[model samples]
Target chain A: MALLTVQDLTMHYRTKLGGVHAVDGVSFAMAEGEAIGLVGESGCGKTSVAMALLRLLPDNAQILGGEILFEGRDLVKLSEHEMRKVRWRSISMVFQAAMNSLNPVYRVGQQIIEAIQQHLSVSEREARSRVAEHYNLVGLDPKLMDRYPHEYSGGMKQRAVIAMALACSPKLIIADEPTTALDVIVQDRILRRINEVRAEFNMAMMYISHDIAVIAEVAERIGVMYAGWIVEMADTVSVFKHPAHPYTIALMSAFPSIKGDKRVLAQLPGEPPNLLAPPSGCRFHPRCPHATAECVDEAPRLEEIDKGHFVSCWHPQRRSQ
Target chain B: MLRFVGGRLVQIAITFFLFLTVVFFLFQAMPGDYTKQFIMNPRIPPAAREALKVRLGLTDSVWGQYVNYVRNVFTGNLGLSFEHYPREVWDVIKERLPRTAILFLVASVMAFVWGFPLGRYIAWKRGQTLDYTITVAGVLFYTIFTPLLALMLLFVFANQLGWFRTGGFLTPRLWLTPPSSPQSIFIWLAATLAGLGTWAVLARFATRRIGHPRPRRLAQRGLVVVGVGLAGLGWWASGLGPFAWDIVWHMFLPVLAVTLIAFGGDMLLMRDSMLEVIREDYITTAKAKGLPDKVVRDRHAARTALLPLVTSFTLSIGFVVSGGIVTETMFSWKGMGLTYLNALLIQDYPMAMGCLIFTGILVLVAHLVADLLYAVLDPRIVY
Candidate 1:
């Protein structure tokens, strides 16, 4: 059985303009120790899906429908108190580290220790030792643990945040743009460290990032999200080698491959659809090159196009031809 | 840090001297002197008036008098008040300082004590009915005229309900036996507070290495409560109860009026600051840690939100030395503001300048203290 299965999870943000369809019908499953990368353009509901899974959404966010089956229990039906027990203990998150993610006034070690003690009935000494161990895991000096967030460089702060997320030894860790704000060298090192830590713990992870290349490096499976829907999902190699969905194809073509023959990077036309009043048919059809009359009038549900491969498009293989 | 403090002190001294000089010159440039009140009187002869001018130093060159004024100020002799003839400016200020300090400082503390939590809650519940209701209500109270609110509170609480004294700092009947002066009462209160504060600090330091946080915090709070209780009981048992009660009873309405008017601004400020802080990424990180909602709001959000509130609070307290003119006047409390106003109207240069200089020094010191507090509260700030 999968460690976590989310079926038809729908969430909307109630704003003055209207209900923003942020995460509409997002569905995926992760087995224990599996790593899935959800890559999409900014504001394509990747972060929303992560927030929905953790139930850390703001006041305006409303979960319209979903069943998050985790460990054979429906998390959507769990009370807030019960859900809190699931968080950080069973499932923790590594937020965007460079965006003041740690409290400015608190010691970095104290924050990690807090996460450790919140889940486990450990003394401060035990929590501190655990924090030190995690600090070493993330390649940070244990001495810097007592320092405030501002005292650390951007890369060090990210490492500290990663240590905090790993302190609890959570079953599943959702990392959202963990290295987006760091330099390329630091980003690569941090990504490698995250993969090493994940491998050591044999933990499940759902990586959220706009940089598909970064996700490609660490994620075993990749889910391509567009306009609040997962347009395609498959093994990383298969998705990269033969992207079946037109949107996925366009996304793949947008990135410059270092090894590929010289070619102009393809620019996908048009902007992301407005979620408040999203298009009636396929949310991506307005910008889909293979869009037809049927694509304009009817939305296609995600269907298994091959073994272990899913695509939500009227003409999934048309882009390959 | 010492260097920073020392530099700030130097800056304060220079600013204070400049403030004194400007006040002295402004009073000098006024149309007349304190002797103007005796202009229409025929009781004094010309020769006597000349002696009085000499005694008041009105006949000296303006530059020479300014030098003398600065020297006397540096020597801590603010000169005699013309309105209160033989009374020195410092003596008059000392006599009234306690009354104003007690009323305004108590009201300011009361405002923040309640305002901060209310603002935090309303911000946490933003967009709800409670939030809107409180925002509207706070804005209403904040925008109301100070004197008008004081009058309304005075009439209802003192006249209609007859629950407390109508006005003034103390009832004359209760003060007939002269239990103690207001200055002594203020001094005693300050000393007791200092003692309690020191005890609380030491208790916190004693428990700094405690393994468990929740119990340590509880014990610290318990110690403070016990300390305050003991102090209060000791004061009452020492036979200061009647004097204290009399003063409290008479000043209750004024303090309430001031608090009611003042807390709204603090509430609104805290609400805005909290609203901005709750949107920060750390707040979401705190939530993801599986901490309770209250912990996220208070520990993670409210603590950061308190930065701006601290700045507002310290500066407001600094202004306490200036005293509230409308509140004091409406309630018939003769504090610093009333004295300063009377001196200015009658051109009592020394007393008016004394008040202005004192206020300036307090504000300057408060700013320096605020900068230090910011560095302490927010570790990102270096000296």
Candidate 2:
């Protein structure tokens, strides 16, 4: 059994523009102690997948159809009261903007203590000691635990949020585009810290970001998302080395380094199709160069082209292997 | 910090000069006769009244009279009072000013002392039943008309219950026209400067200093606080009753009423200001530091959020003065507001104009004080 399985999960958002098919029939499963990357365009439903998995989707959003089985428990059926117990305990997430995520009027220690004490039946002093211990683990000075959030640098704030997520020692952590908002230097440091946490605790994580280069560094398995569907999923090394699906080939060709010596940077023409009313046959057909009559009429289902490697394109080998 | 204050002072002087010029011509727009109140109702011979007008420069062009009035004001003579039996405009103001100043200032302080902490509690527990209860109760208490609230408190605690004095500055016998001796002078001075309301509220809402915060650098902080308090008290003492105790005794009600009113406003403003500040991202950072919510709120948010409240203090001067319109009348206290109301009815033109000019100056000064305070609270905020 997988550590986490999200099968046929469909999440639609009712927006002012109309019903947005934010996460349409997305399916994936994670093994214990595995790290996966969900790479996509800005609105290609990566965040929707993360938010839906946590049941933290906003008021107007609805899980239209789905089954999210985590350790044999169906998370979708749990009430908000029951789910609150699961959040920050069974599953935790860290967002891109760490500073704004925390409450300003509270001390960093108190917020962590709140998470720890809220989840466990521990006394205040014990919660505080654990808070001090976590601060030390993040390489922050435990003595400055009484300071305000503003006193810390941007990197420190992100680390604090990471520590907060780890308060319950959650099995699976979801980090959504965590480095997208940080400076280049700070981004490297945050990624290093996240990797260390996983190594130390053996926690499975879902890393979401637009930068394929950053995702390549940490993600063991990579999933390229187009519109609301996963166009391709494979071992990171294999996907980086051998591009298969046309969208994946286009994505690799566009990033000069991805195709090794042969691939010079090549830009894809036009934009990702609007998920609200995407193309009938294939979401990426408009952007796919080798799109055929069959591609224009039939959407490709994800098929295992090789062992533990997946592709969802009619002409999977469009480019020279 | 010092530079911001200096700039504000210069701004205030420019504003004061412009307003002073405007007030000089206010009488020119009015249709009242400054010389008529002193004249009898019986028909004076037309010649005598005309002669009286001429002697008083009533026949002069409005500009000429205005120029002369401004000149006299500069020379320390604010002309004479038509409302007071026989006194100058300057004297009448000097006599009534202290009571108003003492009452207003003390009330403002008392209100902040009560409201700030209460507002914080309500904010910290926002959306809870206790928070809602306090918030609703505060709004309701503040909504009750000042005079009526005073009367109701008076009725329950004094008339019906005889727990406290109903209204008035002192024992009715101690009302002062002028000091008869040295002891009466002390009474006048004390009563005119001290807050009767603060005395009462302090007793009811006596709070020990928060954090059991032992004054660190005790000698230095203690002296500064005492010195500042004394300076403020001295300024207030300069304008009140003739004798010390009588002035202090009479100041009781006006001061108390002001304090009560301020209690609600400052606290409510604080509650709002704190709620807004704590919602910012920095609060979460503060929380992640492992500081308790209490320390985070008080140290991080409270001091920065206090800037708006300091700016708000400028507005309280107007409320205290306007509020004194009722406080003075209820207590039978003779202050600028009560005296102005009387002058309006009797059509005492000189007294009325004097009151208007006086209030306009006080309002301007209060506004200047508020602007100066901003730099002190948050030096980074430049406006």
Candidate 3:
């Protein structure tokens, strides 16, 4: 059985206009100790899905229909009290914007220790030891933990956040754009450290990011999301080499590769559909090159065309072409 | 930190000197002499009036008078009041300072104690009916005129209910007599020292347990003020020989009026600050850590939200020494507010200058303390 499975998970945000289908019918499963990247544009609901898995969505958001199963228990059905037990113990998150993700007034170590003491009945001294160990795991000096977030450089703060996420040895860690605010060199180093920590702990990870290149480097399996739906999910190598969904193909072609033939980067024609009043079919159909009348009338479902590979599209791209 | 404080002290000295110079010249520029108020009869000889002007140094040139004034101020003379003949300005201020200090101190404490938690709750419950109701109420209280509020409070509590005295710092029945015997004076001194010692111990513990240093430091300062104020009151009580509780009863209406007026702004400030802080990424991180809702709100959100309120609290303390002018006046409370008002009414320049100068120093010291507090509260803030 998979370590975590999100089935038919739908979430909506109540806004002035109407209910926004931010995470609509998103389904995926992660095996034990596996890493899956949820890649999408800014508004594609990848972050929403991460937040939903943790049940940390803002007050305006509602989990319309979903089942988040972790270790054979349905998390969506659990009370807030019960869910809190799962969070930080079973699942923890490294939030986006590392610069602001730690309280400014508190020392970084204090924040990590707070998380440790909250879930575990550890003495302050024991929690401090655990914080030091996690800090070392994330390649941050334990002494630097005494400093406030503003005192640390962007890369150091990101490492501190990763340390906080890893403090509890959670079964699953959701890293939501963890390195987005850092420089290229810092991002590379932080990502490497995250991979090392994950390997050591054997924890499942859901890496959410808009940058497919970063995801390609860290995620073993990749799920391509467009407008609140995962259009493709497969091993990273297969997804990159032979993108089955049209949206995935367009997204891949849009990036300028170092080794590929010199050509203008392919741009997807339109924006992600407005989830408040989404297009009445496959969300990517309007922007798809080969969208047809049937594509507009019927939404596609994720179907396994090959072992361990899924594609959601009315017209899956041919590998030969 | 020492260097920063030293620099601030030097700046305060310069500013105070300039203030003294300006105040002297400004009053000198006023039409008609202030000493004229001292003369009751026009039938008095011109020679007698001239001698009075010379004796008071009113006959000297502006430059000579300025020098004499600066020298006298440095020597702590503070000059004598023209309206209150033979009474020194400093003596008058000393007599009135404690009453004003206690009244405003209590009001400020009430404001902070009531405002902070209430504001934080409203912010945490933002967008709910409770938030809206409290916010509206806060706005109403904050915008109400000070004298009007004071009068309304006096009318309700003192007039309608008749539960407390309408005004005054003390009952007329209790005559305050200084402890003359050496043994009695020694006992009062020992009691005051004991109170100070107890406060010091509690303040040390409070600093350690309070977590955040800014509020802890504030609490420490507040503890000192309360301790000293209470000790002084105790000393007075001992001297006065079993006074009635009527003094406290009299203070109720004015303190309530002052607190009502001041607390609204503080609550609104805290609410707005907490609203912004709740949106910070750290709060979301705290929630994701499986911390309880209360922990997230208070520890993660409210701690950061308290930065602005720290500065505001310091500024409010600066105002404390001056007392609530309109509130004191409306309730007939004989605090520094009424003292300043009386000096201004009779154009008693010496007394006015002394009060204004003291207020200025307090304000300057408050800012310095605030700057120091910012560094303590947020490690990121450097002097």
**Highest DockQ model number:** 1
| Ten contiguous residues with the weakest lDDT in model 1 chain B | B185-194
Taking the candidates in order, what DockQ does each have? 0.81, 0.15, 0.80
Top candidate (lDDT): 1
lDDT of 3 by residue, A1-321 (tens): 799999999999999999999988999999999999999999899999999888989999999997999999998899999999888989999888878988888888999999898889899999999999988888889999788888898888888889999888899999999899888998999999899889888999989999999999999999998899988999999898888899888888888888946888888887878889999888888888899999899999999987888999989987731
Q: Is candidate 1 or candidate 3 better by lDDT?
A: 1
Model 1 DockQ vs. reference? 0.81
**Weakest 10 consecutive residues of candidate 1 chain A by summed lDDT:** A312-321
The CAPRI class of candidate 1 is high
Q: What is the lDDT of residue A143 in candidate 1?
A: 96
- Sorting all predicted structures by TM-score, with the top scorer first, yields 1, 3, 2
TM-score of 1: 0.94
Per-model TM-score on C-alpha atoms: 0.94, 0.64, 0.91
Per-residue C-alpha lDDT of model 1 across residues B122-146, encoded as one tens digit per residue: 9999989999999999998899988
Compute the TM-score of each model's chain A versus the native chain A and list the values: 0.97, 0.95, 0.98
For candidate 2, lDDT tens digit of each residue in B1-383?
Answer: 57766886788667766676775565456666755654675677667877867865678997787777767765767777655656888787876776677667767777787888888878877779998888877777667688887777667766786656655555545543543543345444445335443344443334333324454335435554555476457745665333444445456555676676677777778889988987665554344333455766787678667778878877677555556788788777777789888877655656776777777677777776776566445544346
Q: How well is candidate 2 docked (DockQ)?
A: 0.15
lDDT, candidate 2, residue A65? 88
**Quality of candidate 2's docking, in CAPRI categories?**
incorrect
| lDDT per residue (tens digit) for residues B57-100 in model 3 | 78789899889888999887889987677898887787666667
List residue ranges in candidate 3 displaced over 4 A: B35-55, B173-244, B321-323
